[model samples]
Target: MAKKKTTQDPALAQNRKARFNYAIEDTLEAGVVLTGTEIKSVRAGQITIGDGFVTINGGQAILTNVHIAPYENGNQFNVDPLRNRVLLLHKKQIVRLAVEAKEAGVTIVPLKVYLKHGFAKVLLGIGRGKKQYDKRQSIKKRDQERDLNRRFKN
Candidate 1:
C-alpha cells in the first residue's frame, strides 16, 4: 500500500528570545507530557514558552516555566499555568546533554512548541549564553540592517 500524504504543519509556539539571547549550537525535537486541560489550552493557542528552560533531573529531561492557561470552562480539571512539564528523550541523549550542560556557560532552552499529527511537541536547543559585547554587536548589526532596508525603500 502507498503511504498516506500528511498535511500537518510543524509549528505551535515560538520563543523569539531563544534566538536573540544565546548562540544556539544544536537543536532537538521532543515530545511534551501534558495534562488534559493543558493540551486543550495548547490546541487553542493559549500557551507561552518564552521564559521556559530545559533541565535534566532524575535522569529525565523536563521543561520549566512554560505557561499554559486554563480553559475558561475548565475549573476543577485545569492544569497549573506554571508547572514544570516533562520532556521525552532517549537516555543517550539525556546523558550527552547532562555532560554538555556541565561545561562553562552552556545551557538548554526551549526554542519553540509545535504540533505533529495533533501531538504537542517542543524544539529544544543547546546554546551558549551570549556576552554583553556580543549582544551589543547583534543589536548594532540589526540596526544597520534596518537602516539599509529603509534606505533601499526610499
Candidate 2:
C-alpha cells in the first residue's frame, strides 16, 4: 500500500499528555503573540508545550509555561524563554473559556502549536481532568486496539 500524505504542517510543539489526562470538551484555534526571536525559535521547532496552559486574567487569554528557546543569533533580542505570552482571541471566546474554566476540574490547555498562513497558532482545548480510574480505562482501551491491529495484520 502507498503511504498516505497530509498537507498540514507538523506541529512545532504538542502537549501529548493533555489528551491522555483530560477529557477534551471543545477545541479552537487561536493566534499567538510572539516576539521576533520567539517566532524564529518556533519556526525552527524549538518549543515545548507539554507543561503549558491557558489562563484568562483581566479578560485576556495568556499562554503560560511554554518554553520557546532563544534564537541562536538573537542576542539582545531574545526574551525570557518561559515568559507568559498573550493569546489573540476574541472577547466572546475569552469570556466563554473563562466561564468554562471556572467550573470544577475544567481547564484550558494548549494542545498544539503550529504555523498557519505564516502566523503561529495554538490549538486550545477546553477539558475536564480525568480521574485515575478513567485513565486506567483509557489505557485498557488503547491496549485492546493495539492487540486487535496486530492480530489483523498477521
Candidate 2 Cα deviation (angstroms), residue 2: 19
| Top of the candidates by lDDT | 2
TM-scores, all candidates, are: 0.89, 0.94
**Residue-level lDDT tens digits of model 2 in 28-90:** 999999999999999999999999999889999999999999999999999999999999999
Query: Model 2 Cα displacement at 140 (Å)?
Result: 0.2
Compute the lDDT of residue 117 as modeled in candidate 1: 81
lDDT of 1 by residue, 1-154 (tens): 9998775555568888887899999999889999888888998889888899988899999899998999888899996899888888999998998999889999899998888888898889999999889999999999999999999999
Q: After superposition, how far is residue 101 of candidate 1 from its true place, in Å?
A: 1.1
lDDT of 1 at 134: 90
